[model samples]
Target: MTAVLDEAIKKASITWVSVGDGPAYALWCMPVESSLIVVTGPGEQHAPGLTSAPTATVRLRGDHGGLIVTAEATVTRLDHAGEEWAEIAPQLAGKRLNASGPAAEVVARWAATGCAIVRLTPAEGTPVTAPHLPDDSAAAPPRETPARVETRRPFRLHRVRPPRT
Candidate 1:
C-alpha cells in the first residue's frame, strides 16, 4: 500500500463533507474510539437545533478495508479547552483537518443550538482501498511516450452574499 493509503487508515481524523440547504461545507473530523469531533463556524446554518449535523457517511479511500461507519449519530460541542487542543494537535498528528478558531467554534457552539451528539457504530463492511496504478510485468509490451497538454488561466474571484436569514 502507498503511504497515503496507510496514513488514511491510521488517521484518526477525516474530512467531513456536510451537505445542507446551501452549498456543501467540508469540515475536519477527528474520530475517537467510538465518536467524532469537528470544527465549524458560528452561524444559524451550523448552529444546533437550527442547523443539521452531518451524517457519518464518510468515504474511506484505502487499500485495506476502508472503514465506512454506517449508523445513527449525535452531535456535540467539544468544550473550549478541548477545542483549543484539537486545533494544534490534529496537524502535528498528520491528519486531514483545518484547525482555525472559526472552524473549531462551529463544533463548540453546538450546545447553544441544542444539537445532539451522536455515536456511530459500523453496521456493514467498511469499504477498502484498491491500487490506483496498474501492476507492471516483465512480459508487458513496450510503451511509447505521449504528448502533454498544457493550459493556464489567470486567477479571478466572484463574491456573492450568503442566502437570506
Candidate 2:
C-alpha cells in the first residue's frame, strides 16, 4: 500500500486536495515516508480553509471525474529552530519555488510569518474510485450536426508592402 502511494506521488508533482467543505485546489506536493508534505499560507501558496479541516480529498490527478484518496490531515506549525525543524526545513526548502539564501534563513522567514506544513496521511480504506463515470450512452445526443458560434476578432487584418533597398 505504501509502495503504491509512494510511486504515485513520485510521478505526480501536484495533487488536487480539498479540505473540509472547501473546493478542491491544486498544491505542489512532496512525498515523505508514508505521508505527503505540502506548504501553504500567507506569502507562499494559498489553499484556504485547510487548517480547520479534519480530513481532505486528495485527487491523484484532479479526477477524470473519478479517482481520489481521502486522508487525515496532520498540521505542524514550525518554530524558528528545533531538531525536527532542522531536518524538515531543508526538505521543505528544496521543494519551494525561487527560494534564495541559506536553508536556515529561509526557514526562519517562514517561521517569522505563519506558514502551515500539512502532512496528509492516507486513510486505511481502499483508494476511492468514485462512482458514476460517464459512458457513451450517457453522453449528450449528437449536437444535431454541431452548432458554431461566430466570434469577432479583436484586430483587423491588413497587408503592407516592405520598402525596397
TM-score of each: 0.33, 0.65
In candidate 2, where is summed lDDT lowest over 10 consecutive residues? 132-141
- Which 10-residue window in model 1 sums to the lowest lDDT? 42-51
Task: Supply the global lDDT for candidate 1.
Answer: 0.39
Candidate 2 vs. true structure, TM-score: 0.65
lDDT of each: 0.39, 0.64
lDDT of 2 by residue, 22-106 (tens): 5677788877776677777777777777766667766564324323433444444444466766677678877777887776667
**Residues 1-165 of candidate 1: C-alpha lDDT, one tens digit per residue:** 334433553564543333333332334455654444444444322422312444344334233434332222344443434554445333322442343355445444544554433332222343233443324321334333354445677555876568999
Q: Highest lDDT: give the candidate number.
A: 2
The runs of at least 3 residues in candidate 1 whose Cα sits more than 4 Å from the true structure, single-residue gaps closed, are 1-10, 16-25, 39-56, 61-108, 131-165
